[model samples]
Target chain A: MCRMCDWLGEGQIWYKNPKLHANRMYKLREPGRKPQESLRGNIVGSNLHEALEAKANGDLATFNRLIAEKNAADARKVGAQPIPLNEAIEVIKTLQMPVAAMMCICRKATRAEEETNLNEYSCLALGTGMFKWERWPERYRGGVEFLKPQDACDWLEYWDKRGMMHLIMEEGNDFLGGICNCDYPDCNPIRQRVDYGLDQQLVKGEYICEVDFKRCNGCGECLGRCHFNALKFEVTIDRPSIDPMVCFGCALCQTACNRGAINLVPRSAYPALRNVW
Target chain B: MNVVINPKITVDYERCTTPFDCKRCIRICPPAVFVVYDIESHRGYEVDKKQPGTYKMLPLYRDKCTGCMKCVEVCPVDALTVKMPEEMLT
Candidate 1:
C-alpha cells in the first residue's frame, strides 16, 4: 500500500473510502473573511525547470533539494492516482454531492483546446470545488455542466473508450475533488511524473495488469493505449508482455484487448509490487 | 565537465493580445511548453478572460523546448522568440 492508503485508507484503498468524498459545501466564517484558498494556490509551479537546470549544471545538491521541496509541496497540495473504469464508476456511485463536467485545465494549458460544450468537457469536478469553480476562471473557462450520477458514469465510460486514463485528484488534505480523463503530455500530473521525475505528484494504482498468453493473438492493439510505456510488443513471444513495475493500473489496455486476454490483479498479490507505489 | 545551457524563450506580452483567444503558441508547440494562465487569479478568484490583458502565456517548461522555433513561426503577433545560447552552438 502507498503512504496515502496507510494514512487514510482505514485498512482499504484510500480513494475507495467514502470519507474523503464528504466535503462541507459551505463553511461558516466571519464577515469580510475570504473563502478558503483554492487548491491552485498550493501548487508550487516551475520548480521542475529549476531542478532540471541544477541537474544539468552538475549541482546534484540543489537538484535533490528542489525535488524534495517539490515533493513535499505536492504532498501538501494537489496529487493524483490512476484508477480503472469500474473503480471510477464505483467512486461516482458513492458521491453524495453533485458531479460537474468541466473543461480539462491540463488540456487547456498544454493543447490550448477550449472545451466549452458539455460533450467536450473531459474532467469531472467533485464536492464543493464545483460550487466555487468561478474562483479559477482560467481553469473553469467555459463554466461547468452538472451531470446526474448515470450521466457521469457514461462520461467516464466514453473517455475510457477513447483511451484516456482515469485519475482521481486530491484537492487538499484528503479531499477527493476531481476525476481527470487525460493522456500523457497533455495531463500535467502524468507529464510531470513521467518526464521530469516528479513521482509524488502522481501515484500508481493499487492494481497491476496481467496478460494471459494463452488467450493472446499479438494483434498489437493494446500497445498504443498505454501511456506508461508498460506495454510493449514482444516478437519472440508473439504477444505483448506487461511490466508490472511500470504499470499505473489504468486498465486502458485491458479494455482495448478484444479477446479479454488481460486482467487486473491487486498489486499486493505480487510481493515485489506491493510497495512499488 | 560539460556545461548545459537551456534555450531561452521569451513571450512579449505587450505585443501579444488576447492570449486566451489566440493561443497560437500554446497550440503549435510540439512539447506543449507554453501555459496560458491568469496571473491575478493565483490567489483564487475569478478574472474575466474577455477583458484585454487578463491572461498571460508563459513558456513554463523551457527545458522541454527543442529550439525548433515552431512556436516562434506560428505566433501571429511575433511575440515569441527562442534563442540558443553561444555555448550550445559549439
Candidate 2:
C-alpha cells in the first residue's frame, strides 16, 4: 500500500467514500461559487506547454525559467499521490460504485495519428463523479461506459500487464479524481517528473523494488518494463541491478519477473528513501 | 498557442516502405511527436498473404518536439530527417 492510502484508507479510502467525496465537492463548489472551476488554475498546464515549446526551440534559458516557475507553482498546490498497482486495484474494487473508462487525453493529443485505430480507453474514473460527468463536457468527451468491479479489475490488470503505471489522482486537491493508466513517453506527469526533474505533480509510490541475486536469472525481462530507467543488467555480473534512487516503486518490474526473485519492500524500511517522493 | 518552437520532420515516404511494420520513430520518440495515420486504400505492406491497409507516420505534435532525434537514430530504414531550430543548434 502507498503512504497516502496507508494514511487515508481508514474506514473507507477517504477520496473514494461517497459521503466524504460529496463533502469535498460541496466545499469545492459551495452552492454556486463559480462552479469550483477546475481548481487547477490554468498556470501549471500553460507553463508546461510553454516549457515544452522552449525546449523544442533549444532555448535553455527560457526552458529552465519556465520549468522552475512551473515546479514552484506545483509545489504550492496540494494534489494527487501516486499509489502502487495493488492499492489502486484495492481502491477500485472497494469503491463498490460505478467505474468508467475514458479515452486517454494525453495519448489522443500526442499520438493523434494512432487515435482512430487504437483503443485509448485506458483512463478509469471511479466513484459517483460519473453521475454528473456531463457537468464537465470536456473531460467526458466520447462519453464514459460503466464497468463492473470485476471488469474494472480486469481492465486495470490488462494495462498493468502491458507495462502501464497506475496513478491515482486527487481531483481539485481533495476529491479522489480517478486512476490514470500511464506510460513513460506519453503521460505528462510521468514524463515531467522523470525527464524534466519536476516532482510536484506526482509523488513516489510507497514501496521499492529489491532483487535477490541468489535465485535470479538475468533474462532481462524486467529491465524493459521499468519506465524510470532504474533497472539495468550489470553486464559483468550478468544480473539485473536496480538503482533505488530512480525507482518509482511501481513494482512493474516485480510483476515482470518470472523468477520470483524480485520483491516490493516497504519504502519505510529504507529511512533514506521514505520521504524521497 | 502559437509557441516558441516547431520542429521540421521530413519523412521520405518513398523510402518509408513499411511504416506500420517498422514504427521506430513512433516508438522511440519520447515526446510522442510521431504517430501512425491510416491510408484508406491498402497500397503497401503485405501481411498474412493480403495487403493490409497502409499507415503513414506524421509529426502530430511538432511543437512538442525537443529535437532529441531518437526517432532519427532509431529508424533502420533511414527515412526520417530532423531539422532543429537555430537556437537549438547552439
Candidate 3:
C-alpha cells in the first residue's frame, strides 16, 4: 500500500502499479490457468444477466455505456422503473456528495490494474460508517439508524465472502449515524484493514482506563468516564480497579484521567472481531 | 446436472442474525435469483425446490453465473457456493 497516498481515496491513479496482488495482480502475473482460477469459478447465466453482472463488476464499461445510450433513447427520468445505467451512475455520484462535500475520503487497499474502457481508467472507491451510503447508488434508504450491532455484524458477514466488507473505528464512526455498508474503493476503514503493509495507521482502541497506583485523589473523574462501570476507586491506593470484561474498549476513561494514570493494555485479538471473514 | 446445495455453503444461524439489514444476495447477483424481502429475515431457512414456496430463496442463478466464484468467495458467513458442475463439462 502507498502509505501517504492511502490518505487519498484515489491513491495516485495506480492502474499500472505492480504491488496489488489479490484482485488484478494475481490474475495478471500468474500463468494463464492459475491466474484465471478466481474468474473461472463463476457460475453461468443468461445474456441479459451476464450484461447486468458485467456492469456491476465494472468489467463491461462499453456494454454499460451502450445500455445507457439505449435507455436514453427510451427517455427515462429519476426514480423511474429500471433506472438506466447512466442514472445508476448518477445515483452513485449523488450518494458520494457528502464525501465530496467533506473531502474525507481515503484509499486503503490496492488494485493491480483495470483495463481502461473508452480510454478512461476507473477511479476506485471505499468508505465506512455513513460514508457507505455514498458508495452504493442502489441502496439509498439510510436504515442503519434502525439497525443494531448484530445487524451491522450480519451486514459485514454478507460482504466478507466476496471480499467486500470491513470495519470502521469507534473514533471515526458512531452507529447511530454511521453507514452500514462499504464499497472496496469507497471506504477507508476497510482499505486500511486489508492493506498488506503497515498496521500502525489503523487505531486499535488500546490505551484505555487502567489506574495508576500512585495517584488517589479520589476525585472520581475516572469513575465518571467509566460508562461500562469498569472503574471503581479502591480508596487505599488512591486509584481505581477495573473490570476487564465490562470494559468494551470504549477508551473514554483514558480521556478522563487527569493525572495521566489510566492506560489501556494490549491483549489478544478482539473476540467479536475474529468473525471478520 | 444434479443440484444440491454445495457442502461448503454452510449458514451459521447464530451468526446469520437474520431478518437483518440487507438482502445481500439480491444486491450481489448480476441477475438476482434470490428475491430478498427488505422487511423479512430469511436467516436459517432453506428452499424446497419441490414444493417451491412463494417466499422462495434464489435458485443457483446457475444459468447466469459466469463461474466468477465472486459470490462464493465473498460470502461473509459462507451462505453461498459454486462447485464443479460435472455433467456439462465432461
lDDT of 2 at A244: 90
TM-score of 3: 0.25
Worst 10 residues of 3 chain A by lDDT: A76-85
Q: Judged by DockQ cut-offs, is candidate 1 incorrect, acceptable, medium or high?
A: acceptable
Write down the lDDT of every candidate, Cα atoms only: 0.80, 0.69, 0.34
TM-score of chain A of 1: 0.87
The positional error of residue A49 in candidate 3, measured at the CA in angstroms, is 36
User: What is each candidate's DockQ, to 2 decimals?
Assistant: 0.34, 0.16, 0.03
lDDT of 3 by residue, B1-90 (tens): 312222122234344333123335444655333332222323323222223222223332233344556655655766666553454345
DockQ for candidate 2: 0.16
Q: What is the C-alpha lDDT profile of model 1 across A88-155, one tens digit per residue?
A: 99998876567999888888767767788888999998876687767764567667998998999999
A216, model 2: CA deviation in Å? 2.3
Which regions of candidate 3 fall more than 4 Å away from where they truly are? Answer: A1-208, A235-238, A268-277, B1-90
**Residues forming the 10-long window of minimal summed lDDT in candidate 1 chain A:** A20-29
Worst 10 residues of 1 chain B by lDDT: B41-50
Candidate 3 lDDT over A135-169, as tens digits, reads 54323322113223333334333433232322221
Range of the 10 consecutive residues with the lowest summed lDDT in candidate 2 chain A: A109-118
